[model samples]
Target: MSSKFLFAALGLGFMLASCGNQKSEYDRFYEQDYKDSVSEAVANAPEPAPGTRTPSAPAQQQPAQEVHPGSKLIAGSDCTACHSNQQKLVGPAYVEVAAKYEENDKNREYLIGKILEGGAGVWGQVPMPPHPNLNKDDAGKMVDYILSLNN
Candidate 1:
């Protein structure tokens, strides 16, 4: 009986030890496989045509996106999490907003107020959360950025 118990205990200990080492061995195998696949893909990739930019080309060779002061302010805030310039997410796209309203002082002021105070129903049922932290001038900048998308 004692021998049987000892054998069972040793078997369990060995099983647990093997299980622990198995994960690390599996991880090493997976990492090697991933590296091999990436290397193969790079090797198989076609070379860039003459006059075209290569993958290793400097960023300065690429055309830069124009940035506005209002865009800079919006990028620093939580606006991007919900809104995009072209595609709609939680709210309408900036372009959509711009399209709906004409560029003018009254509309600009109204949008600034909406940004600061928050509102719903104009676009849909989802209410735009208020931005109490942002001042009127900053909100106006954001509004300007959105409206500029029309042009």
Candidate 2:
């Protein structure tokens, strides 16, 4: 009887542990997207004219970082596992991609397709894994962010 009780307790404990307070993947992605959107808004906000500042406002406001929506998507997804903005890892650096391809409609479409279909021979032998689950709109956003790095 005691052995049976112990086993039951262990199973209960395992179930409780599995259900512990942890953010779901969607929750994490949503939070990151919200944060990035706010940052982008702040970054794009026009500064007040020199004489228009209220006395109560701080003398100097640091420039807000311009975060792209795609950056959040990339962060939330598995892209960062192999790629980075500044340096190459398992894949080419995002900056390199930007440098290679000028931002244009044709390039954008091509890149979006590449993201969905995956490819190799362009960035060396290691093939880029396809993201069948990611939609074209999201892929285009990611490409925009990567291409923006050129500037």
> After best superposition, candidate 1 residue 40: deviation in angstroms?
11
Q: Which residue pairs show collisions in model 1?
A: none
Best-matching candidate per TM-score:
1
- Candidate 2 per-residue lDDT over residues 59-144, each given as its tens digit: 23223365578877886798877887776888999999999999999999999999999999998999999999999999989999
State the number of backbone clashes in model 1.
0
Give stretches of model 1 more than 4 Å off. Answer: 1-66
Q: Considering summed lDDT, which 10 consecutive residues are worst modelled in model 1?
A: 53-62
TM-score of each: 0.60, 0.57
lDDT of 1 by residue, 7-40 (tens): 4455445444555464676766655555555556
